[model samples]
Target chain A: MARLSSENLETAYEIIARYPVKKSALIPLLHLAQEQDGWVTDVAMAHIAELVEVTPAEVIGTCTFYEMFKRKPVGKYVVNICTNISCQLLGGEELLHHAEQKLAIKAGATTADGLFTIEDVECIAACTEAPCLQVNYRYFHKITHGEFDSLIDDLKAGTRDEIPAHGTLAKVRQHIPAARRAGAVAPTDRAEPVWLIRNRQEGAS
Target chain B: MTMNDVPKIITSRFDQGDAHTLDGYRRTHGYEGLAAALEKTPQQVADEVKAASLLGRGGAGFPAGIKWTLAPANVWPRYLVVNGDESEPGTYKDRMLLERDPHQLIEGVLIACYAVGCGQAFLYIRGEMAHAQERMAAALNEAYAAGFVGKNILGTDFSVDVVLHWGAGAYIVGEETALIESLEGNRGMPRLKPPFFPAAKGLYMQPTIVNNVETLSNLPWIIRNGVDEWNKLGAETSKGTRVFAVSGHVNNPGVFEVEFGVTTFRDIIFDPKFAGGIRGGKALKAFIPGGASAPWFYEEHLDLPLEKVAIDRAGSMLGSGAIVVMDEDTDMVKAALRLVRFFARESCGKCTPCREGTTWMEKIMQRILDGHGRPEDVALLMDTADNISVDFMWPPRMTTICPLGQSATTPIASAVMRFKDEFERYVGGPIELNVTVKGAAFIGPPTRKKEGSGV
Candidate 1:
């Protein structure tokens, strides 16, 4: 299915308008596209390229470089377990092993029904909450085995509604008035905007 | 060293539940700093920051006011980029400030943007910080609606537009130059020094001022309280309270704000007000005094001061103010391996020394952890690390475009030096080679010859 539907186009343009240059919105636009689909697809990448006015290769370069973007289909719920130094010292590795045993699948693998995918990720800057994990970017502080199992059960039963689907980044959308939106200037053009020139500054775009 | 019964700067507001909201922030005297700041000229505001003894809360601990002055004078439209990508393994005070008291950060941003005459600013937050990002984005909208941002901020002739950029998932973006490159829409790889420094030519090729989230977060407090009050909080060389993230094997493993040099590593670990001592009554074996990048410290060095120069003189650093505690049961080799693996994954494949050196060390560490280490491997590991490392010289030499390679090697070197006996146990032995393979099986050293009939 086409990920970036016509309904999302206006919202996409508003996001694009937030940057002085079109390419600067590449990452945010990718978040919007992923918000529409569970993971980034070739079609969605193409759609993003068209929306942001960049080549598909450029979009893919930015997308693949970041670990958050998934190239293939992800499970309904992506359980990202943080196993960096702080968490590792506090049973982060054991937690991952426990998860593997309970799920009957290794990390980076999804269940047969495709409800969950366990990923051993880098630090989320939440070192204070060790043995911590995130499901769809929502924190499950100091997660224990029992809590983990019940969380999986909750996800399987479709009971956890606080967090959105796998690809959704935010609960709120940004709406910029057309007048206040940053009009995109060509990369080749060195011409400055009235506001920038009024401040005696050259536009970095 | 300056000490108080409790912290007065950032942590003073932590008890308030609704501090994240604009109203709650105002109730706690948040935006008053920005209001007080707007009354003065940009240079006057800059002078007040210079008058204070504030050091960058980020690992580097560079003078924040000095950084503001480095932004090119003739260049107009200077940008202020706040590095909210707090991905260092043991460091996380930025996430706390962003989530708990967000408007304070926004107010700080407004003030910093004013001090440097930056018409635009960007908050480059890490991808995993969804809640932090959500709060910050909401705060920005609140700021715009309340006239704290946008055209003619606070009825002053100043106007600045702040952009919130989310990192997909690269730790290298924590570097200022790499952050700028990422904000411009590319891979978050560190740029070569010389011409690519942010202050000289930053985002979109303009003079830029990049500060840490916690560093800028303190600006509001310093601007409101005046320079003399801040200078009284820490050592002669260092000033103000730093919010430290205390994690791993500690009873009260959380963030703590303590005046620099006033508290020792011992106090941070055992003090009742801080981390209530190591968990389970286990003796402390070693600790990562800084984030993962800093060299590990042993139990004997508990008396070391928390000041940057003191810690640096002690052969470690007070990096990012992240104190990761380790108990007697902790495995130094395994811990070092995890750190190297983190760097390997987040290396960004930029310059040779970092990219190749990190992955190479990961493989070597994996072999060592797997009990396949040879007597020569320990020396080999040091050799590999030395190739990427830079000692504390005047210029501070480094092999990579960024400091990632250096960080990747720090743990290995320190762990090996402090725990040489541990490495010896695995030496002169081969791991279970036929070991049941699972997932990406043993991607051995690159130099491993192509064995077996080219099947």
Candidate 2:
């Protein structure tokens, strides 16, 4: 519902510079928007469309095509469990069921308190570590029921809260020189990159 | 010679100490190939690769050497697009290479760029591979800082820039043109062929050469090892070793590098050295010889050699060199559903057949697996698959814009064709939706409560 704060807009321009064409930055910008909000909100998509000079429909098209971009709001952590052939063969389905029961919700549901959202994702290419799952895109390999239970406990206690919210890319915000030039990228069009020092609260779910 | 006797080639540094680091890579015959390639003309480099007969390690198994050779002269500023969208269900080899030994891929990129006279290259890594992306991005930065990727690499007139792009998560993007589309920041939909073929016209409507991560990763070895040495390996027509991402119902499910025709599905799935036979001594039921794109191979085909010619002759593919094995306890109907679900979700809505056909098959599979089916459902699935590609006619025949139609159809057609009894059992039975079946548990819903859906 809210637009990216002023500081993130500066980061947007810099990301665009990384590509020869600004449109190529769409996926990255969507990632940036996600970092701002827990999911890619409709307003955020519109804002991204303006930034990349594409129609909102085009943004929606690309965004919907991707399974990672959540159009609707999700919990603080999105637990994506790969249930593909490899995962299925080696306890991936059972893991999903376990998570569902553990969280008191089904495969695609978020907890009532909005702390976690469980997803039965496809193969993440980590077949060797069969019962693997990712929390906010960070992999947990060879996971077991006990490990998952402990992880959930850590998440609840905020001990495993080192990772930022579901939408955030990295816990730290970087203010670097522009790729094309040396000048510090000022907040553009009055939008700015949410600096770590200022927006520490934003990363909190 | 046995598989172990063959040169390690690209996968040698897999387990070495700190292999991910640049220093670790350089110490172990890493970029020597780039240095060697820098001394030769682009044409000479292309000729050497062609002579070596290095086929594309991606799904197509096309000649990697000839791909570079096919870059048309009329199009200035040719581009090299590396397919790193390793989303095919069983394939994860590229993820390992990108995360562990990305410098090798970079050196190969530099060589391929030099050989193809291209000044720009883009590695479109899968969105799900966040760690692989981080490693590759870090590796690219190191390569640039070290003067390997930027202007006048190794102090020559040649200058090339590499842009490391990320896909949002479209399996279809692995299909070169769709990759180009996603790289351009559009919905990753496959473009119609003839005019849209990548070599002749691609990426901003310019000539381009798209190679797989493994295909380009092999370049450094080809340039350094010499063509004759490369040719001596592998069966005729297909040269060089490929990294097979073996998973599912095996003792040691992991990535293995092997020469073409040197081994068989039986060896990879059953040999102690490879997958080490199906897990818990379970009887091997079926396997996907390639990634999801290839057809299913049954017990009768276990001895079939893992090669392009052999696989093609058996009516399947060596696609992406991903072999996912299954055991007797697995449900064939549910397995087909898993693959169809993937295809349906990843269809991209670009073509009529792929977009609609995959979804239709998914619905039917869900119904059948949920204990609501008729005898005609099996025939209907095969019939629909036939309409989708009808044996994957090449040169833009009966297929859709890309091979995705065939990819969507392959598993279903092959599964129903090989194991009709399984489908029949599910069909004529009562609607007993067993949510307890571990591997097949995620097949359908009512599995999820409506309002509780996070998205």
Candidate 3:
């Protein structure tokens, strides 16, 4: 077990003080220690217990309670796939399998190269696009087996760069002049067409 | 929003009778829970609830009786806040209860108010959920017209009012304090904990009891069915039936009430009576045992029971009982990127780590996905995550202000930890410019401004 650094202890106390119930800040404090050390160790839990004036059992209990906190060391990149109702109906299961096979690691296991850790997540709320996944924090929607393979291949090949610029509503309006007009298909409605078309296209294939 | 409303639990009582209308509610068993409670001692009501062993169904499996008992008794004009803002991604069980069974929620609210000595109850719904708002409002009006909601209910001196408030469509508002803030007309940012426990100081500074839609809905049933009977349905630690919204990779995806520990992932996912497994014999890739923020589970964890304790042991959570399944043919990097995008967008921007961390993480993810990543950037991404996580520990305690801030890094941190190779694969690659914009922007004020302006 790694020693809980003084810095992490101080940080934990600071968080506990901010909340009405020190226990409430437990999740965030664990996040900090894990962030600093790359994982939550037993030593860290003991320090958090001291900071929050709770028992080590309590700290560990809360840590083990939530899914977000990492008790063990993880890989460098986490692939979170959405396999909820919407994403499932949209082929989330198949996409997940493809990812696991391509990465050569089952979901929840780090790759042999220590480069990737794949996880399955619940609904991302981008149901309209369906079958979505998040590499790090960016969303890739309306994915297909081919698209999924290509995304991994591109990541592997290091051929894709530059974050997709956030396209403002204005940019969307510029593309479809009718969008700016009143009663022009609502932006949400307009957005659905692409995904719907993609779904149909994939279905046809 | 339609006439084909199905009466599940609460609505069954209101819909079958004229109780949906104010006059009808008066004639029927409207406010009966409150009336029953008012006749008995508050302690007795609390005891009954405790005996019921009812647990909160809004993600955390907190005991309802324990929550009510925690409220400081000295505080007057206490509040009973109902969290109707069902924003936990893939968890729509509450919406069904709120829209179709509003009266049940109302009765449960009144009972909870009476038990906790609360004077008012507020139902905070997401701003986007206009239809739910309408149905709830109409239900409240009916209760009021029937003399259940307004002053001097049933000729007893006790009076309580149920108010409906709309949120600005923020997922963070689902947090109790944040919901209180939004109800109070502030930006829907979550407050720091320790001194902010809603039971002690909530709403406009008074003791409060915040329960989720499903939790409150369960109250009337608990009262109807003794705690022992309710506890008989599930595990000893987690008693009673829970409503799970099963979605993703299932033949039939909908909400089903199953006893705690009585169901398994395979039973739900592969059972023809339930989800019936992934479509078209597609192989299962991963599964999110809870809401979006919960850690992912692979096929190895399939037989794991879909219960709080079981999932927790598996390094995941049974969050809101929203089981999202992913199949083969999915990209791990892209999936992680999508979740990161959600955290970035949904972040209330109150805490530095969450606000900047989520945005930066999204950017890094995008770069990797777009094929513009550098090998060293992988470590940089980890460093950035480390920095944000440090910030995540501040403010609300030296971390971000609320669960939103802390949870914002969940997908990114987990992804980077679990899928580093996939991220490394994207390093040193030319950017893939195959970005396609699918839908019109969601109907909301522009979150990002034109270039040159301070975003």
Candidate 4:
């Protein structure tokens, strides 16, 4: 069965340690699983379930609820085009059409060479930068047809080194130093909150 | 006064390219609020913010300080969850804050943590915001390294830790309770209020104060300069400057900070320094006073001040501080369909009315847009909207649990009622079906393909 690599397991443990309840780490762990592979596999879900101490069905339930997590295999680059109200007003629909024609695949389909996937997404919070597209979650705001084509060309030719693969949300991972961590003990392990004990002591004094 | 005359409090460091960096932030009076806040007791800090009357910029316009004081007194381990999961259709101010001046937000988070007696704060950014997440994460790490966060911040007794959590693309998580649910590794479905209010019983069954990123970003300025200075700005009820993210058919569509209650919808849309009027010198047909959820406002309503009360009286809200202008050329029917389709897609499917009703509304609107509208289709759209929201009035009476149901009704009700003639034009026989995919944007049970139809 597919599982997180040893290094990824270590990083997963670090993330789980940040939350009081280990289950709170479920989303981040799922992201990590996706990061390991482009799409989340059943075995990866099972692995995350075991790590987060939830059932595979529970994991799948949470996973399916979000729009980002892909169940099936996808291309390396996921091109999400915003076609909501603001973007639509500024030719978002036209851009989506243009992308479909350019890529020779439909909105939800991956390319024949398994390099790119186009999706007509809703608002991605960049309303000001209308008609925006994100390749592997990296933004290309206010893109024209020419810019988009050039971007695609760059992606195909491996010239756009700034953009990463589909699952990589950020190139720079967050690191919390040991001294700075808020005691991420399991909630059940504590009789009462640590702050409560301090508060009680201060009040009594 | 114009926007230039208004002080840029929260967005002070926006133009500074290095504001996201620790050094850049320090050079520009950063962390001064945190310093000022630490000098006062937590109660004192809370009191000052309450006095300042800083309203939440994440839509609802509730006072941030008042929200902080609502938690049961001395509730240990009270959590401060910053709502950076900003995916509102026309809202992007929070995104700018996240990407540009993350340290400012971090400082605000630290101050808010101290004020609310929280030992830990969870910063939930949106999944699609990769740049924002990176900027915020980098800023947070720099802050921790500099001792602004985690364990005796700035050599003071007060210590707070902020965990950076990103959502997996659920707009429903923007709702406070749904955000809490998402934080707890559950499906991002909103829990019913009364028993499940975050202030009373929240994350891990303890008290939590969920604040908008923009709301928290105000804390530093208020704390540094004092409430008197803050009170000098804005109107009587709504105090402080608000970051208005203006978009759509405008010449210069971007985020601008203006003193709240002073500016009008017209000033925001037409002012040279702001949106710079509509694109292509076109006449304004209609504009969303706020985010997509608010009812559309026409040219007559342009004079209304950008105040919560004034806009509310005019039958719409300055929701999420997003102003999307629509020009004369925009097809009202198609525009309504665009927004309706958004609500339907992002309904979260928790409540039956919102899930089913929004889909129905989207379908009917799509059918009309597809030139296959029946004569009664407009009434059908209104009927479906009425079913979702008990009435088409402002502050809609909802049949569903969350406001998402009522939000679906706004575009249809606003568009159909105001421009009945335009909706009528799409009716009768098949007009030019420009849309390639019939009902492709909507989500529901798939219909059988019609002959020669673009399915």
lDDT string for model 2 (B343-403, tens) is: 8887888788888899999998999999887777766776676678654332113567787
- Model 2 residue A167 CA deviation in Å: 2.6
lDDT of 3 by residue, B92-121 (tens): 677666656677788888778766766656
The 10-residue segment of model 4 chain A with minimum total lDDT is A185-194
Which candidate has the top score in DockQ?
A: 4
Better of 1 and 4 by TM-score: 4
* Higher-scoring candidate on DockQ, 1 or 2: 1
Please give, for residues B1-455, the per-residue lDDT of candidate 4 as tens digits.
Answer: 55567788988888898999999999989999899987776767889999998888898988888898899875566788999988888998898898999998999998888777786789999988899999998998999988998887888667767899989998889999999999999999999997989999889888889999999998888999999999988888889898888999999998998989888777889999889999999999888878988887776677777788877765678989989999999898999998898899899998998999989998988998998888688777777777777656667775776799888878877777667678878896322221111111121122422311210
Candidate 1, CAPRI quality class derived from DockQ: acceptable
Cα-lDDT of candidate 2: 0.77
lDDT of 1 by residue, A1-205 (tens): 4658887787777767777677888888788778788888889889888877889999999998998898888888899998999999988989999999988889999998888899999988778899899999999989898999999888878899998889887675444333333323332334332333443432233
lDDT (Cα, tens digit) per residue for candidate 1, span B1-455? 33446456887777899888888888989799999987766667888898785789887889999988887666655778899999888888998898888898989998998877676778888888888888888887777777787767777667777777788888888898988888888888777878878888888887889899988888888889888788878777888788888999999988988886667888889987889998889999888888988777766568766887767655667879888999999888899999999999989887888889899999998998898878788777877776777442212257777788877877776677666677777775422221121111012111222321010
Q: What is the lDDT of residue B192 in candidate 3?
A: 76
User: Regarding DockQ, does 2 or 3 come out ahead?
Assistant: 2
Candidate 1 or 2, higher lDDT? Answer: 1
Steric clash pairs (candidate 1):
none
- TM-score for all models, in order of appearance: 0.91, 0.88, 0.63, 0.94
Model 2, span A28-102: residue lDDT tens: 889889888888999988998998899999999888888889989899989999888778878888999999989
CAPRI band of model 3?
incorrect
